[model samples]
Target: MFPIRDHNPSGRVPYVTYALLAVNIAVFVVSWFGLRSEYALAEFYYTWGLVPAWLMQGEGYSTLISHMFLHGGWMHLAGNMLFLWIFGDNLEDVLGHLRYFLFYLACGLAAAALQVAGDPGFDGPLIGASGAIAGVLGGYLVLFPRARVDVLLIFIIFFRVFSIPAWVVLGIWFAVQSFNGYSATADGVAYLAHVGGFIAGAVLVLPVLLRRGFWVQNKGKPPHPAAEYLFSPSRIPRVPKR
Candidate 1:
């Protein structure tokens, strides 16, 4: 299951989030079209993507940030952008655009750190925005635990959209990441990076919430214009017009 959208509409246009989407797509296109050869693509990833061994050798330090803008393929890019589109605007709303951008960078750095810590000797290049996007998921869970999200569920041939609380969605996600980080032996995916970025986002959003008085004054308060979240997905039956 994955989320396609959220019911809590952002109060403002998320310029930073859209800008990020543009950059990531543009980079992927360039990597695919300009590089032209598998060897060249691999070389580009080695130089720009986060490689734990390179980092340990006191080089490629910039990959921590640059890596967040790179992706391995179309599905990878689409997935990350979808998450960013759904959740990023909310955090941007709460924190303002500039601070949200910094928060994203900090989370990406934390994610890269944890991925390297998991296997400092691994040489393969790690490329994707998933780690940083996981951080956004973390922050979204904390601030809008009760908000409704539109999750697209796929089970073999069946497909459906389930509208559920953010906590349920993010909680299940965190559990999967943790399980993979600790137990699964998947080679390409950086599970630990996901786990670390999520934790970082949750931790980083706290001070902002406290400073803004949301922690005290609006504790447990939900989205305004409550009607916006009243309906789930399109699959659910709508009321008949009078």
Candidate 2:
């Protein structure tokens, strides 16, 4: 199950969030079209994506930032963008544009560091905005645990949407990431980076959460009015029984 949207709406327009989405999409398009062959794509990833081995050797330092904008595939790009779109605006609203951008970068750097520390010998390129977006999820959970999120669950041919608490969704996500980080095989997913970014984001946003007295006053929910979406009846006319 993955969250499709949240009830929490930001009080201000999230310019930084929109800019991030635009940048990631533009970079993906450039990478998708510019790299005509697999070899060239691989070369591009190696050069721009974070390589743990190179990072450990104090090489390809630029990848630490570049990798956050690069994605492994279309689904990877889509998934990261979706998460960022869902959770990022609220944090940007709270942190403001400049600070939010810095927080995103800091969380991404922390994620890269943890991934390198987790498996320093691995030479594969680590690319995706998941680590950074995971940080956004972390901060959102801290500030809006009680917020309602609509989650879509897919069971092969069956599908359904459920409204659940933000804590439930994000908490389960963190648990899965942590569990996979420890128990899963080499599936090319940087679970350690996700974990590190999440923790970093939670810690980084603590001050804002505290100053707002969100816990004491709002009780972990967003201070602003939560957006409520009501599903209306289908517009299609029903067929009469024969």
55-149 per-residue lDDT for model 1 (tens digits): 89998888888999999988888988999999999899888999999999989988988989989999988888888889999999888888778
RMSD of 1: 3.5
Q: In terms of TM-score, which candidate is strongest? A: 2
Model 2, 1-242: lDDT tens per residue? 89899888899999999999999999999989988999999999999999999888889999999999998889999999999999999999989999999999999999988989989988999999988998999999998899889898899998877888999999999999999999854788999999999999999999987897767888877777877776622446889999
Which residues of candidate 2, in runs, are more than 4 Å off? 230-242
TM-score of each: 0.91, 0.93
Q: List the residue pairs that clash in candidate 1.
A: none
Q: Which ten residues in a row have the lowest lDDT in candidate 1?
A: 218-227
> Cα lDDT for residue 86, model 1?
91
